[model samples]
Target: MTVVQIRPARSADADAIAALILPIQQQEFGIPITREAQPDLADVQGFYQQGSGNFWVAEAGGAVVGSIGLRDIGGRQAALRKMFVAPAWRGAHHGVAQGLLDTLLQWAAAQAVAEVYLGTTAQFLAAHRFYEKNGFAMVDRAALPPAFPVMAVDSRFYRLRLG
Candidate 1:
C-alpha cells in the first residue's frame, strides 16, 4: 500500500491543486473552463485567510495527487467542495478520498456541525458512489443554494448527518 499523507493546503499548493482539478472539471463539464472557473493559488490562499473554509491536499511519494475542501455553511453545517484525485491515482487507494472525508468530518465535528453536504455532477458517477459509501444520502435539488448552477443540470446533492 502506498503511504498517503493528508495536510492542510498551503499557498504553494494552489497551482498544483488547480492543475489536478482543471482537467477533471473540463472533462466532466464538456467545456473549456474560463479563468473564473479555474481555481488558482491565490484563491486557495484567500480561503485560508477568510477562516470560512479548509483545504487539504494528499501527497504520495512527495507528490500531490488529490485535494478536497470544506466550506462552512451557516448553522452547524458545511459544504464539501473541490474534491479531485488525479486520474493517475484513482482506484484501490480509495482510502485517499476516505481520508479526506474523515478529515473534513473531524473538522466539522469540532465546529459543532451536525451535518455535511456536497454537490457533484452526474457525470461523476464514481463520486456519487463514493459519497454514498461514505454515508451520504441524495437530497432534493431545491435544498441547495440558488447560486449553485451546476445543480440545475448535472448536479446532485448528498448529505451526511454527523450527529
Candidate 2:
C-alpha cells in the first residue's frame, strides 16, 4: 500500500494540482471545463491559502493524487472547492478523498468555520453520495449563502455545518 501524505498546499504545487484536477473535471466527468476557468489553481496562495481558508494535497510517491480547498467567504462560512482524487487513488483501499476531507474539516474547525458549502455538477453521482455520507446535506441553490462561490457547471449544492 502506498503511504499517502496529506499536507497544506504550497504555491509550488500549482502545476501538480492543476494536473490532478483538470482531467477529472473534463475527461472523466465530461464537464468540458478548461484550465482557464479554474483560475484559483494558478494561485493557490493568493486564492486559497489566504485569510482563514486553505488548500490541501494528498501525496503518494511524491505526486499529488488528491486535492481539496477551502475558500473563506467571511461570516465564518467557507466554500469547498477543487476536490478531486485520481482514479487510481480513490475508494476505501486508498482513502485519498477521505483523508483530504478530514484534513479540510479539521482545518476549518480550527479556523472557526461555521459552515462549509460545496457546489458540484449533477453528473457526479459518486461525489453526491460521498458528500452525503460525510454529513453534508443536500441544499437548494436558494439556500446557498450569497458568498458561496458557485461554479458555472455546478447544479447540485450541499452544506455541512461546523462548530
Tell me which residue pairs clash in candidate 2: none
User: Can you write out model 2's per-residue Cα lDDT over 51-160, one digit (the tens) per residue?
Assistant: 88999999999999999999999999999999999999989888889999999999999999999999999899999999999999999999999988889999999999
Model 1 Cα shift for residue 102 (angstroms): 1.2
Deviation in Å, model 1, residue 158 alpha carbon: 1.0
After TM-score superposition, the amount by which residue 35's alpha carbon in candidate 2 deviates from its true location, in angstroms, is 0.8
> Which regions of candidate 1 deviate over 4 angstroms?
28-31, 39-41, 48-52, 145-154
How far residue 111's Cα lies from its native spot in candidate 1, in Å, is: 1.7
Model 1 accuracy (lDDT, Cα): 0.75
lDDT of 1 by residue, 14-72 (tens): 77887777777777557466546544345876653244468899998888888988776
The ten-residue window of minimal lDDT in model 2 covers 29-38
Pairs that clash in candidate 1: none
Worst lDDT run of 10 residues, candidate 1, spans: 145-154
- Tell me the number of clashing residue pairs for each predicted model: 0, 0
Query: Which candidate number has the best lDDT?
Result: 2
